[model samples]
Target chain A: MLKFDEGKVLKNMEGALKLRPQINEVIDDVFSRGFSNVCWLGIGGTYASAMQAVVHMKERTELETFYENAAVFLTTGNKRVTKDTFVVISSVTGSTEEVVQAVKKCKEIGAKVLGFIDKADTELASLVDYLISYPLNEQLKFFMVGDRFMYLAGEFAEYDEFYSEMDQHFAKGIVEVEKAADEFGKEFAKKHHEDAIHYFVGAGNQWGATYSYAMCYWEEQHWIKTKSIEAHEFFHGMFEIVERDTPVTIYVTEDTQRALSERVARFIPQICGNYTIIDAKDYDVPGISEKFRGTLSPFILHAVNNRIDVHVEQINRHPMEIRRYYRQLDY
Target chain B: MLKFDEGKVLKNMEGALKLRPQINEVIDDVFSRGFSNVCWLGIGGTYASAMQAVVHMKERTELETFYENAAVFLTTGNKRVTKDTFVVISSVTGSTEEVVQAVKKCKEIGAKVLGFIDKADTELASLVDYLISYPLNEQLKFFMVGDRFMYLAGEFAEYDEFYSEMDQHFAKGIVEVEKAADEFGKEFAKKHHEDAIHYFVGAGNQWGATYSYAMCYWEEQHWIKTKSIEAHEFFHGMFEIVERDTPVTIYVTEDTQRALSERVARFIPQICGNYTIIDAKDYDVPGISEKFRGTLSPFILHAVNNRIDVHVEQINRHPMEIRRYYRQLDY
Candidate 1:
């Protein structure tokens, strides 16, 4: 893998899985306290991550869960967010103004805030009632929180077995996924890195990954213009702009909405000759259960894309860390 | 105005407002019968329309309201939707496949279905329990149903007065808005109709309009490529792709999320040399109350965009009704 450090990646995943006991403890405490509902708040990429959790929660559990944009929540202030609400938040930088302010307000409203922060001394860590600090996978942390809550509530019975498997083999599985995808990622970047723009489509739990990758990684990190559309909405209006030479990517997952993206995949080749389909079913996670593929597809797909990001940076000659206006210039 | 029939628009608006009494009656009947929650279902454009309604419902009322994509609803049935749920839907052609299927399933589940159809006879019209047939403004009809429900629930105190004012002068006020926006619309289309692509940013209630206009009209109707970003998410990752010459348009409204879009509007001029700001505050709806502007900004902003759509059609030499894929071919 180009520009990839396997040791560091494995270490991060191991550290993330190590937080399982703490996550279980926090979720058990919250369940014992008896909250009204679950509210997950974030901005940008984290918001997209929360959306994935909300989709899974809606499908598998009867819990009333809301994934709200932190900035909008700050401005509009959800009425359902009260003293009995269990608010979950995450911030890697720990200095995102909107996240900090939202956490402050959530604390003021007497809601129990559980936050995953990267540093122990960050403002967000101080504001949250329960803080889990680690440079770990945010997606795994989110699902840990959600899975534990559902397990306690009797909505998810296989939670213990699932996490036990994840704690052992998930890091090694992610590394294998990246290695398997490196060749295709390099080819994709080499062929279409300089295209006018890119179009991405995905559905089910993978929609959030598609959205975040297009905006947060391609656009923000590499300054590549891209449009991400939900597979269900792809035929509605976006298909009209596709030509024979247009570059497009479609993600197919093993979720219930697999048919939705499969529909897009079937049609894209008819109109767009330059298209790629990234199917999660193609990758084999050594020790994970087949039934849990839908639940873990987003994380697997993201690791696959990380390979593409490395190749894109190397081939396009654009460093991933450059920014024009974000935090560099004031509005 | 170029290619615009003011008389037809005025008559359509007048006809839509005429459904006030019937909408009120249906809402009253549903309320008296007592439903559990309100669910608005649609696909694509209609889904975007339902989103605007949901934003208002969340802000003003305590009623449990959900705006769901019809396709997703059919694929993954909602646990909240039951016999006591009130499902509201609309289809201009009244034969959208996913919508018809969802409505049929809802009926089978014993939930009451209220539909707005433009024709008296269609598959969807037959599926719904309560049908309102007319060629009316979907946005107006949506709000009418929502306002009536809120008024009955005591969430909206001035509902009757607001509807009375709308009946008297809303159509005429809309005509004034179009007339007022004609020159700007013409100039905007003349300058940017040939641009490689367009980027739109909007927040709060105006976000749905921005999304629908960008994808539904620009891409589907005119074959123009465009990207629409929610204003709050603008700074996160999308901003990094914007250059000095990007053709960006920001929509500013009077809603609580006004500051969100205003931030984008203020920053665009600093980054992009060629940018446009469509502020709803500049438009005056003569008969509507000043305090109701935030609630009405989406309609006002949409009407303003309609003017631009007309000019874009004329200036770009592309007919708005032409479609390359949508309904023209089998995918």
Candidate 2:
């Protein structure tokens, strides 16, 4: 595998699994303390991740769950976010200015904040009331918090089966998915690395992944021009921009909204000659129940897309970490 | 005003105001009949408009309001959208497949639907329990419905003053705004109509305007490529793709989230030399109160951006209503 480090991957996945007890404890403490509502607060990519969790919470529970981007929350306060609100936030750098400001505001209002941070020695890490160190598994960690809370609230009945299977197969299955997707990723990167612009589409839980991958990875990391359309919104106006030779990719999930992107997948072939479909259903994750496959498609996608990112970076000769303006100058 | 029709604009705006009595009657009847929650449903541009209303509702009221794109709602089905749910939807064509399907599902579940349609004879008009013909005032009509509901529930104290002012000045003031913005719009279109791609940034209530203008107008109507980034999310990744000569346009509003876009505006000039700032504050609605200005920024932006659309259409020599794929071809 190109640029692949199996040991580090396994270590991180194993570490995420090891945090189950800690995650459960945090959820238990938050429940015991009693919260009026749950507010998922994050900045940029983290906000997209929070949106996925909020969508899940809305589907499975009657719990009052609100998802807000950190900057919006900081500027325009939510009346629902009060002292009794349980706020969940995540940061890879753990020092994103907006997230730090939002966390400070939450602390000022006495809201209980559970923060997932990669770095343990950052401003956001110190601001959070309950901290969980999730160096690699951001979405997995978020699902653990949300699903455990829903289990206690009687909204998630399959919590036991889901996590039990996750413990057994998730780490290894994900690595296998990465290796499986490596070849296709290389071909895709080789063909479309220098395309004028890439149009990406995804639906259901993968919409956040679609948005984040396009903005955070393609635009920021790879310095590529791209537009991400929600599978549901693709037909509304975006389809008009498609041509026979356009570089298009539609990500299909095994979720209930599968048909939404499947609709795009079917239509794209009719109009676009150059297209790619990254269906989560194509990936095999042993030991995970069929009923719970939809819930984990995003993580499946993460594995598949990580391979593509590696190949794209290598082919383009552009380091994913290079940035022209971000964190280099004061705005 | 190149290609502007003042008469048609005034008639449409006035017509929307004239529907106030009918709109109030529908809301009064819905309130008397009782409802559990409000669900704003639409596809694409209409969905974006509903988002602006949802943001306003979230800011001002504690009502259980859910905004869902019609396609997603049609497939996944919200458990919260029940027989007692007040479903609000808008469609220009009123024959959008997914919206009609979602409306049918809502009907099957006995949900009362209030639909805003431009055409009175479309299929959606026959399906909705309550219909309001809003040919041009989609956002205004949505605000009327939401603000009226909030007023009836005692959540909006300034509702009386707000509507009274809207009735007096909204139509004419919006025309003035359009006229005021025509020269700037003409110059902007002349300068950037042929740019490779336009990057649009907006926040708060005006974010919907930003999104719709970029996708519905730029991409769909004009066949031009564009990427609309939320103001709060701009610094996240989109800013990295912006060069000194990148054609970036940031939409600013007078809402609580003003600071969010303002921050983007402040930063864009520092990096991108070829950037346009379309500030809603620059275009004033004479009779509207200062306190209510933020609430009407989307409409103000509509007036401003409409001028830009006219010029872009004229400059690009593309008919705004011409579509290669939309209604002409069946997927």
Candidate 3:
């Protein structure tokens, strides 16, 4: 629990959860008034965070949803984007340059823009047609941003029952996450303290979390060498690099594609000497149903991994806030 | 030229080119009729190869094009896939289990399945509604598969002029790739022969080739540590790992988003001690108009990297064909 603030984490998470009703209303309004398609645009970690929700919307609804890098999308105009299209863009800080430009472009196209940010006075809030601003504290930014987006997407896709369940049990879920993190964080750091390359694997909705954690936390924050591969694609090419002592982290979610991760989990231990499997089923959610657990797996796994981030930061003596180049230098 | 058979490469590439007219006819027939949307489904390298074409289609055409992993798609069924949907699937062997399952699922949904394979008698050829089979020699497979897919996608989007120019000048383009590769590959091998981790950066349509080369050739074939990051996403997180001696390869394509790659190209040398830039513009693609070169960048870059692959294979004494786990073990 080094540098961990339990009260702040709970309060920020609760603040995000409280936005559910407002987000649902906004989604309902968009749905009631017909729209052509939905586009999710963000930069870096924000884009990675929206991936699972985009996948969920694509799988569960006929609505055409695109998850794109904001800068790339601005430069390469999507033919599907039009006046009737609805775009949802997110940035923890509403002043991200690429996102600001994206919002401007969306406005020129006359598309309805929904901006998600931490402050209402920022440029994005001024440009977007609607705004959902919340406090994005460092402790809970990833989980809160991911949760809000997924909840909105689910509501738009008419998963009312699932949304209701998430609203009811997520607060309780965090308590379990805190307890589990305190235990797993120290253990993972103790075993994986050396300077080594790590491979993180997940499937289904959890793939986004796997990717985000690998890039945003491990590589960006800690300067660790890591590669995040989807479990479905693991055996194809990436697995060839695995040795008996390779460090591999497997996140097994409760989704339908759990079988895919299980397949990898079964195979890795046979060939890899150091492999850790973190299953969402190990964490207890007091009121959440088994079927609904799959939908909320990304949020839960993210919370668990966030703790690992804290441990890795402490063990390495590398403050998570330190950046060698990201915001320090001009590209 | 270290281990390359120029004549065989030319012959196989020419054979793949011969299928152009047939591919055009099929695409024309499909477009002339109608389809709900387009789905590009593949696994591993095949999936990575199709990324650029999918992006091109999404940007240029009104049709909703989806690029997805075959196994993931099979497990999480897309709501947009229906009887009217047009699904394109590819595999060199045509016997890939996941691809076969995908073809079955597409057939079950009554979708029009387009299968690209190396042989006509394969299972994928039998299951698909339409089949395009050609000789998939080691040298020509990457360029041919990518070219064929991009060509079909471009034709559907009505890029007749661009396609016509590519047809007239691609053979000449290969010759230029040969010259550049002969020069760059030897120099690269001489300096970086020792085993070390490499970072590959690419933007626009060339991102697929970058990912494919890093995973398939570098990681899988040579057991080298490599991470392929999109140029747009490089500054976001992965760039933090760069140091004075980091080995980085930047692929600068001649596309609309050339500036994105150039941005990274500009920054790397200032911060990193070792960086190699393989710009598509360096090769003189004879008879190919400047406007059309962007579309053919991936093919040219692939040919250039193919030489590097040969050099890496020679320097490391690692046969590109050797497998540690891929196809050597069952999952």
Candidate 4:
């Protein structure tokens, strides 16, 4: 009962791209106002997007940065967070146990709290010190999963040049995502039939995608053994593992340092017991320059990933697996 | 030449364990001075130690930490240090391109610098704002090959209650390590041949050991493939890669946490194309822990891991491998 089909996500993504520059300006303004350290807090797709931003910021800035699990806030009673610290708490639905608790912690610690939410009235928006809003529309296949909304969070900042370019690209992104989703669905299902285990590899920020599509959806939801690894680091020795029982999927993006990305992709088939590549270019994304418009690519890619997650749930005859080997993880 | 003979390391290691409490106290003192963050600077074996220590600290403390390649100081011309940040600089020789340049950065940044050194008059000693001594007497190995020095460090932290116990158990430990090394030498060499591919696995602090011995030393020295993975985490999905083409080695402690350690060991042989297990308890690290003491296990485990590195290098047939890779890694 969603108003927009998966294809419509392509346009929302364009709008999201248009909003990114503004988001960056807002972030920079807050960053200059006096935060010395940055923390990204979220779950699932938003969590993944947060991770990507964390890694990118580390490479992009010399200052201190971290990705914190909301659980840390819930558990640590004596934790010290100061006003000099920049804490970003996000959730697409604007409701999650850990995130809610973390916002409370950030307030107590006197840190600036920035939030991104899909709904204006959501709890996350109500609680954060500075909140940014996005469309609340849900029930859409892609939106049902979180993260695409993160890409939509770009309007909160002052950086407009990049957003304008992304705005232009957003209109056509939906078809590409559907195409990517359909292709991925067929390929993933076909591979799932042959192996009980699956592995996902994303280097650097790709871990964001790897964690969501592989660990959360594929492995956690379907009872498949899914794993993620940094790309360049993989070849030094892990090549031996790929040719065995694990069939790995590689997430390739245009923004990945070109040489490193291609080098890792080329080596995948060598070590993977078997392998497949799912590529997203800037053009294929809601914008150009994989990173220029963070809003468009992550939301589009994650939505496609989400669509496949749904497809796998539908086509598979296997039992639904709810595994709790230990309490450290959740689906 | 080092003052240590074939058996002298065992003697000093025994001596060092007697000094463990003060050693343990001082190790924490390195970080107690209250900086906003820490940057570990070093090269080669010394840098290797810093790498292991930084990771251990990150896993232990809530504080932010990072590693600065000793070489980056050479051309970056960036030295903005402050009370908000500090450096823990290490040097076995006190003379390295990056280590020397780091001193200049420390001066430029106006941040306090702590030098961890084997010699009092090293270049690093003269420049450091605070100095920590990791001295080895003429009767001991100094910075030469063999891990007696690092092992003794482990003993430094838990010298009181564990000294006599370690003395009683050490001969057995040495014998076991020697036996494991000899057997490991023959089999591992045959499998790796001249390719220089190796894998190391450890859990908890042992993961630090794996990173140093298996990844840093093996790969840096030989331009080979060496990777370290968290033992328990590796099995969640990665074990399927162990095949005939690649081999793995693991480091374990006798009193390893029961919940995780045992399960990982049980599955080792199933996936390691080839594998070996060396318990820190029996790894023959003279000065390190004879038995798990009250302090964190990393202190003891890291020293034993250092010893394994020396032993592996001592047995390496490719003598020039280290020299060949040095240029690519010298910084």
Candidate 5:
């Protein structure tokens, strides 16, 4: 529980849960108005977070969903993004230049823009056709947006039930994650602190969480060298880099592609002695249905890993919020 | 040129060029049959190679094009892929298991499957509705496939002219690449040989080449750790890892998104002293049109970097073909 604020975490989760009705209203309004496809646009962590939702929608529904980089989308216009497209833009700061420009482009194309902003009076909130403002927490931001996408993709009733369950036992999930952190954080950090490179592998929806942790948290915040490889692609070429003590974290989620992670699990110990498997199935979430466990694994895994972030910060003596170049100098 | 095979290179180039007309025929035939959308499917390096083609098609035409991971697609089906979808499958050996499975799935869904196979008789070649057999050079494979995609996406006459030009001076481009490799390969290897991690930054079409070289060649072949960060995304988070002596390579291509690369070009030298700029514009590719330069940069860049592979092989004493786990293990 070092450097942890339990009250803040609870408040943030509650605030995110409060946005459920507003998000549902936006989804309903957009569908009723008629849209050709859906685009989830953001930069950096925001883009990474939306990707989990994209994978969920792609698997469960026939809705056309695109997870695009805000800046890259500007330079290379997508042919599928038309006047009738519905765009969901996430920006906690509400001033990310790339997301703002993307919102402008979407507006110019006559697409409906929904903004998930942390501040109500910000530029992004003003620009979007519909806005949902909540407390700024990366995990909560993704969960809310992902929930909305799954709902709009025709899993509304199922997701509503799941969300209701989460509402009742949200505090328990947090407490369980914190307990895991207290048990594993120090050991994980001690084992990996001096490692020059870390390979983060995950399959299915957990791939986004794995990527976000590697790029947004480790590489961006701690300036550590990390490569986020999907479990399926890990065998193709990346496995060659493995050594006896190569630092590897395998995130196992409950999904159709869990076998993919299991394959890596079986193979890694054969080559890498420093590998650690963080299986979401290890966690006990009260009131969550078995059907919804796979869908909610990313959120749970992210919370568990957030503890590792705190421990890593303490062990490495590198403040998690410090960045060497991001927003420090003009590029 | 150290380890250069001029005759074999010319032969390979000729063989790849020979497939152009056949590839075009397939494209024409597929369009004539009337398809709803395009699905470019592959895994690892193959998937990375198809990404540039997907980006080109997305930008130039109104066609809905998807660049999907073969194994991931098998587990989580794409909503856009339907009976009317024209799925393009690339497998050099004609027997990548994931791709074969994906082809089967596409066929099951009644989609027309096109296979780009290296051999005439293989499981994947047999399974696909149409097959184009050719020598498997990564650059050539992508170029041919990308050209086919562009043609199908409504750039027939322009791409046709570009192909004609490439066919004439194809040898010249290879020769120019060999010369650059001869000049710069040893130096690049010497500077980067001791580095533990490499940051490969590229934008536009060059992003695919950068990712391929990083994942397939460096990590797979040499067992050297590398992070392939898109130029636009570099500013977002990846730049935080930069140090004064961090090894970095910026791939600059002549495309609409050249500015994105240029942004990194300007920033990298300021933050990292051991940085190299491999600009495609630096090479003199005789007889290739200015309009066609961006389209062909991947090929030129791949050839130039092949020398780096040779030098890295020599300095690190790691045979490019040696794999610790890939294909050797049953994962």
Candidate 6:
């Protein structure tokens, strides 16, 4: 049976980059398309990647983009699909029931499908007009998720060479990734604060990663609330939720999306006056890949996330129970 | 200046009755074609009504049923609309941007179009081959918003005269609605327990309403964690979150859909022992139409939601704030 794991998937990202030479082609397709709209589609990992990609794309180009809420498919819809739409459809093997269904609809509707598949002779390959394939060898199952992300990030950052450089930089770090995590854990254990709620704020692609890794799964696992939001979006309405007690953590990086996130971070000191700001540019580690490093950056962002949980656990003196309420809603 | 409120709705519910006279026709139309599937599309108030109606239909019929989550267009969706697909396009005026787009696409796909309309010769009416018209007075907004819910519910419950009974029930309850809310507030205040987080759960149509007004908005407004899940789908996972301290309020009714919810409620005691359960069936409010009453049976639910805010404000609790660190993701 195929199973997906968070920690393991994040750690082994190297295998996601055999197609690095084609990075320029994809990036060119993105730039060639300009500030036009895009449709990011996938189930599970692909969905998560699309969120990050769309957010990041918007951050760089200031172009309008939309996310297809996955829940919508099961609820109510039969809207027409358009071929003009740039759909980045990602699947490890390029085959999934929902993804395949979506792909077929897109093809029929004339939407340009940019297929990201891992396996050979996949249906998605024949379906999409443009294709990018990543092999994802076994050891990197732990890392390929990040690897896939870094490849995309490198394209977006417009640094094919810079992206190439990052693969090596990240791999060296992965060798000692555990020691780094342990050391960070030790430091976090001692610096625990009471009643700290983390706000993982970013405007672009990182916003997507922070949301999935930080907000959804992490909070569920640890019972600690982490709100990951687009920084500018935060300013419009959510900033008011800020107060003295709430300690916000901003995940910063040098990627283009940083401008908005940084601006929001700058205002935090003035508004609520206290927040932990980690400049992601200064701290980068990966065995995954460069494109994905930014996407998977939040995994490394556990310095604050872990400590907050450990500290809260130390204080609540209770084990964390991830609560997911799925009660019946009948007539 | 346009604002949509459920209470402001006329609740005349005449459209439902007017449509009832043609119930056999609609039902015949529904079955004769034996269409592959059905699609319902609407926006805002009309959208909510469509949701309620679809859920009601599912509970009343044995035919395979589901809702497509039309994110951009309530009516247009990913499911391929074909000759056999019956498109149920709902628009108060049939002029909403996305609705129009979807209807046009439905025709493009050759699906039979059915419209729930307010005006004769209106855009949606002209677009769909089959037209079901409501009294299109300016006052129909009320029917569009909620009163129709009563009509649909009454029809589902086999109460043919329920709408007129509703006119009487509401006329009576109108005199006491405010007092009821006030009474509800006081009762909530008296037994208000601050020991744990308030968990309000619902599934299906009520679940949609509760999702919009209660969980998403309420949780964000008060910084209290509230989640809603689909009933039957919840059994797959997420049942483990229930605990003794966390009260699970079950909104119950005698409506046909109650079978699933009631079954789930019956199992709750075994799963989470010693939890406070709110079963609206436990209360008595006179003159309320059976289906309407079954629904508003959760009237006290409004006050229960309010009490959560009261407690949150009393605690001065809020989420943290942060500025972005890096904004390097693509736009």
Q: What is the lDDT of candidate 1?
A: 0.87
Global lDDT of model 2: 0.88
Model 6, position A217, has a per-residue lDDT of 41
DockQ value for model 3: 0.76
True contacts kept of 6: 0.05
Higher TM-score: candidate 4 or 6? 4
Q: Ten residues in a row with the worst lDDT in model 1 chain B?
A: B71-80
Rounded to one decimal, what is candidate 6's iRMSD?
Answer: 11.0
lDDT of each residue in A235-271, candidate 6, tens digit only:
4234545666565767775555566667767777765
> Candidate 4, which segments miss by more than 4 Å at Cα?
A1-4, A7-32, A42-47, A72-80, A92-97, A117-126, A133-158, A270-273, A282-304, A318-331, B1-37, B40-64, B67-295, B299-331
Error of 6 at A297 (Å): 5.4
Against the true chain A, what TM-score does chain A of candidate 3 give? 0.91
lDDT per residue (tens digit) for residues B1-331 in model 1: 6766989989988988888888878889999999988998988888888888877776777677878888777765677788999999988888788888999889888999989999878878888888899895888888888888889989899887887888898899988898999898888988888888899999888887788889999999888899999999999999998889999999998988999999998888778898999999999989788888888788788878888889889877899989898887776
Worst 10 residues of 2 chain B by lDDT: B57-66
| lDDT for each residue of candidate 4 in A1-331, tens digit (9 for 90 to 100) | 1123655566565545445444555565664575666667655455666666754443334555556546433442223256777676556667676578778878878888877666778776888877666652111212111222222233224334544554565456555666657756656675564454565666444556676556455655565545455454344323333444556767665443334445667755543456777665633554555455433444455655655655566566544344333233331
lDDT of 4 at B189: 50
Worst 10 residues of 4 chain A by lDDT: A137-146
Per residue, candidate 4 scores C-alpha lDDT tens digits across B162-250 of 44555576534543455445544555554554543465666543454465455445655544555455554444334434455556666
Ranking by TM-score: 1, 2, 5, 3, 4, 6
Model 3 per-residue lDDT at A157? 42
Q: How well is each residue in B272-293 modelled by candidate 5, as lDDT tens digits?
A: 8989998888887889888877
lDDT of 3 by residue, A258-312 (tens): 8889899999988988999998888887777776777667767877877777788
Model 1: per-residue Cα lDDT over A1-331, one tens digit each:
5788999999989988999899989999989979988999999999998988887776677677878889988887777788999999888889999999999899889999999999889878899999999985888899889888889989889987888788888889988999999998888888878878899998888888899999999999988899999898888898999999989999998877888889999888778899999999999899999988888788789987988899989888889988888899997
At residue A305, what lDDT does model 3 achieve?
78
The global C-alpha lDDT for each of the candidates, from Candidate 1 onward, is: 0.87, 0.88, 0.77, 0.51, 0.80, 0.48
User: How close is every model to the real structure, measured as TM-score?
Assistant: 0.98, 0.97, 0.94, 0.56, 0.96, 0.47
Give the poorly placed runs of model 3, Cα more than 4 Å off: A137-160, B137-160
